[model samples]
Target chain A: MNKNFIILGGGQAAVYAAREIRKNDKESNIKILSEENFLPYERPPLSKDFLLNKKNQEDLFFHSSDVLKNENIDFENISINKVDFENKKLFTKNDDFYSYDSLLISTGSENKKLSLDNNLNDDIYYLRNLEEAKTIKEKVSNKNKITIIGGGFIGLEIASSLSQLQKKVTVIEIGSQLMGRIIPKQIADLVQKTHIQYGNEIILNKQINKIIKKNGIYEILLNDNSLIETDFLIAGIGSAPSVKLFEHTNLKLDNGIVTNEFCETSIKDVYAAGDVSNFYHPLYERTIRLESYQHAQNHGICAGKNIAGVKTEYTSIPWMWSDQFNLNLQLTGICDDYDEIIERGNDINNGVIYFFLKNKNIRGACGLGIAGKVGRDIRITSKLTEKNIIVDKQILADQNQKLNKLIQK
Target chain B: MSEENWIEVGSTDSIEEEDLIRFDHQDKTFCVYRLTDGFYATDGICTHEAVHLEDGLVMDDEIECPMHQGIFNIKSGEALSPPACEDLKTYPVKVDNDKIFIKID
Candidate 1:
């Protein structure tokens, strides 16, 4: 008997899992239900290259129109709001039901929106999908004074993109630094300096009191007793797991949907992946849910392989990168609770790396450089962290030492 | 068939074993790799994005892109991972008198 596999959400995780399932089990019936109209597309480029018009819509899709059809995968543009664990079925908003042998929940994450007392104006924007990105692009095409709320990755990336378009952009963050605690203060300061150097204003340690809309302009009132007016407003505060549909269900939910290392949820025949699943990590011995491109794809593959009876564990290192202006930042592994720190390459022109160490083992590593300088070392750092290798501080500090040599040890 | 078509990249000693060098001939860029077996060549830029392949780490037989960690086999130019589905174009290489030459039209 052929198994019926149903994947909810049509993002990176959903699409990758479908492909992997097809690769391992050729006879199974794979169906992908996406909320968005378009096929699965790369979300990383939406704020960077896609905003700059370097990449078109066609270039962002995971596969062509007929590619999924050729693979015998059925894709439907429908939204599922409820799941029946007892009957192994899903119910859409229209009350349509579909039974499945196995199901994967890769609903991904949703951007947190800023609620204001007076949002009479519809000029504010939040980017989560291609449609929202396109809307923001169209709205900001003729606007110059742009104000972005939140100093996270999305906020900073959008600021970088609009700043390159020669717009006057102001970033408002309630926190003390640009990125949150994941990035060290020193590195965050460096990133903040780069943004200022590129002519983008960074306002930190201030909260939004209220927003008053006037004739074709927005007056932003900050708790610091200051006001700034802008032609356009955007918010990238942060995101949370899109687990609204699974609430009040039998499946366990922590920060996200709780799962084992094999991506199996509390219930049998039900699995979760991507940002929605806070699965246990065998390496770190804790549960974590990542919202990066690499994790989504790899986790989905792991889920698919396990569902196909391959029993593969999800053990890939946590890796993600952000591009702002000409500087590229790459982070790998857990970046907290470190007892020692090692610095390598002080100059950002060549590259600068910070290794977070606990008991001499590499807990995490972060690097900032001119685009091409940091990737190789960051990759090596992930490998060292995965293998539980204790690295020497002197060798890590010295730029002359090759990191690959440490891997060979 | 023509002598002018084969472009000399560099001496075989220039690249270490299991490493690659970026060779820009005319306007086209190519990644010339020296693996344990022999020398091979492929398009310098990653098929998924515009990142240079020389910055990528070279495993035994695979080259992982520095940008997104997408990997490609240096020998056959086959894309081995997601985010990079399209295969890279492989070029034929030959060595003569310790000088590595890639046959390009």
Candidate 2:
């Protein structure tokens, strides 16, 4: 008997999981319920190349509409308001219910909005989907002074793009350092310096005292009594898992929907992946919720495999990248709970990589360099971490020594 | 200028086993790979993005793009991963007296 597989989102994870399911089970009816009207597209480029007009709207799409149609992956543009978990039925905003044998929750994440008293500026933007990105691009085309709230990846990436476009950009990070939660101070300092060198102002450890709007301009008052009047404001503080649809349900939920290694939720036939899933990582021995391109695609693939009766585990090491100006930053694995930190290749001209080691085993690696300089090393480091190899500190620090050789050993 | 248009890239010894090196001729760029068997060549830029394949990691006969970790079969130039759907345009290679050369249009 052919089963009905309903993917509850239209993002990378949803589309990839649908494709993987098709590969494993050809006869199963696959339908993708997306809130956005556009076909599932890559979101990373929205803050960088797409914002800069380097990539057009069509370029961001993962597949053409015809491809999805031909693959029998039905993509419906609708938002789900509720779910009947016991009956495996999903209710749309219009009260349309769709029954499924198996359902995947890949709802992804949403931006944390900035709130202020009497803040009624329509120019303020939060980018989470294509429409928001398009609006930002069009709104900022004639605007000059742009203020971005939050120093997270989205905020910084947008700052980089706006700066390249010759816009007066300012970044306000509430934390003492930019990206302070995960990135080390040294790396964040380098990024901050790069931003400063490019004529962009980065204000750290400052909270919004008040927001005053007159005419069409926004005068942002900081905690130190400093004021910033900008033509437009963008916020990218952080994102929380989009798990509102199942708030009243019996499914286990913490930071996200709880799932096991096989992407199995508390419910028998239901699964979760991507940014909305706090899945148990066999490698890290902890449940983590990741929001990145790699995790979305890989976790979706894993969920699809398991749904199609492959019984595969989601064990892909965490890897993500951020492109700011001319620099490329790549981080692999988790960077916490390490006893020793080793630095490799300090020259910014070449590359700089820091490895987090615990008991001589690599736990994570973070590297920054000009464009392509650090990607190869970071990739090798990810492989090394996955293999659980004990690496020597001196050899890992040597610039001339190749990390790839360690993989073979 | 030659009849077959075989441009000598470099010496085979310049590349390690199961590794690759980027070669540029005039405006055209290509990646010359050295396997345990022989040498092969492909376009230098990744099919998915505008990144140099020289910065990519080579594992056996496969080379993963540095930017997105897209894998490609060095001998066949086949894209074997997501984000990379287009196959790389491969060039015919020949080694003469320890020097590597690739046929260019």
Candidate 3:
């Protein structure tokens, strides 16, 4: 039977879902409702190569016009203004209503802006899409001093971009360490140290009080009564899931739209993927929300296969990576509740691999500045973690023992 | 470039059963595999990222990437799984008695 598939928000997850659906049921009508004018593209390079002038705008795009046309997928520049899940009908921003046999929501997330008193500021930028990244990159060339508020992954990434341009960059963090929530303190300190070593002024545990623009320059006041004057301001504070469309529908919403192991939402014939899904992962044995490139891609594939009658469950261990300066931080699984940490390298920058354990078994593992042969072992730590067994602490800590030997028993 | 397109990597005896070995030429890296069907070669780095396939585990006819667990067919160099959408670059391998040669294009 032929089906009509409608995917909301054109991003990695949306594109993957459409591609997966096309791969299985070629007769299905696939329509992608994208808020952006361009088709689904890669978002990772916004802060790295694209912002630093290494890659052009066209290079960041994942699918070309030829590919989309060949796949028989239609890409529309529109947003979901309203949804009628009972009849499986959704209205676009242009008031165009359409019904679907299967609906996949991949609205992703929106950036959080500063709550300052500056009513209308022209120089402030928040990078949530390729267009914003392009605007910031163009503004970077004419500005000498840049101030970035919020020191999370997005903030640190933009700092790296400004650093590449040799701009006087200052990062203000409300937390004591950078990326504290995502990683352990030691790892966060390592990332902070790398940025500092590159000659950027990093201020921690400080909050932005207000923003006052005078004489074409922005004056940002800190909570401690200190003032910072910069030519422009960029906000990378954080992001929240875009779940307004699903809120009216009766779909369960926790931190995001709730989904089961198969990426199916509370309602039937409806699914959600990417950053907008707060899914119950069988691997973690808990309901976790992940915002990453790999998770979205994997979820789309899994959901697509199941929609095609394969019945695949997403039980893969969660993983994320961050590139700061010369440091490559790759982490697997969740370590927030671990009781013990076993580290091999003395310093984080030189190269260190830390394994977190709760009951002598692996809970999670992270490696900083470790690559090549040594990195291959650390990369598979998540696999051992998923085994749900225990390896000797001595063997896991010992750098001499091969990774295969440690997992054999 | 190398004076010869085909460079001798090592002895065929060094290629063990069900093992992935890495060798670098110029600035590029390639993985040499010895499976049940015999020897095959592919680009060293995972198409999803830069992790080397030689560091990954080989099972049956498929090799799993260490970074994300994405699998690839050793014989065809086709990315058989998600997280890796692009097919790996493969090279023709020749065995002259004890010497193993890879034709680098």
The top-ranked prediction according to TM-score is: 2
Q: Sort the predicted structures by TM-score, highest score first.
A: 2, 1, 3
Query: For residues B1-105, what per-residue lDDT tens digits would candidate 1 score against the true structure?
Result: 888888999999999887889999889999999988999999999888787888888889999988778889888999998678789999899999999999886
- Scored against the true structure, residue A91 in model 1 reaches a CA lDDT of 98
lDDT of 3 by residue, A1-409 (tens): 6788898889988888888888888798999999899878777778877887877888777778789899998998876799988988998677789889988888998887776765745557999799999899888789988999888888898898898789989999999888877788887887788888888889999998888889978888899999998987898888888997777669999999899999899999889988999999886678888888888888877877767667889887788777666666778888786889988666543457788998787888877863333345565586688787687778777776656644443
Best by DockQ: 2
Where does candidate 1 stray beyond 4 Å?
A118-121
Segments in model 3 whose C-alpha atoms lie over 4 Å from true places: A120-122, A347-350, A370-375, A404-409, B1-6, B11-22, B25-29, B34-37, B43-88, B95-99
List model 1 lDDT by residue over A122-173, tens digit each: 5679987899999999999999999999999899999999999999999999
What lDDT score belongs to each candidate, Candidate 1 first? 0.90, 0.90, 0.81
Interface RMSD of each: 1.1, 1.0, 3.1
True contacts kept of each: 0.57, 0.54, 0.21
lDDT order, best first, reads: 2, 1, 3
Candidate 1 global TM-score: 0.97
Cα lDDT of model 2 overall?
0.90
Docking class of 1: medium
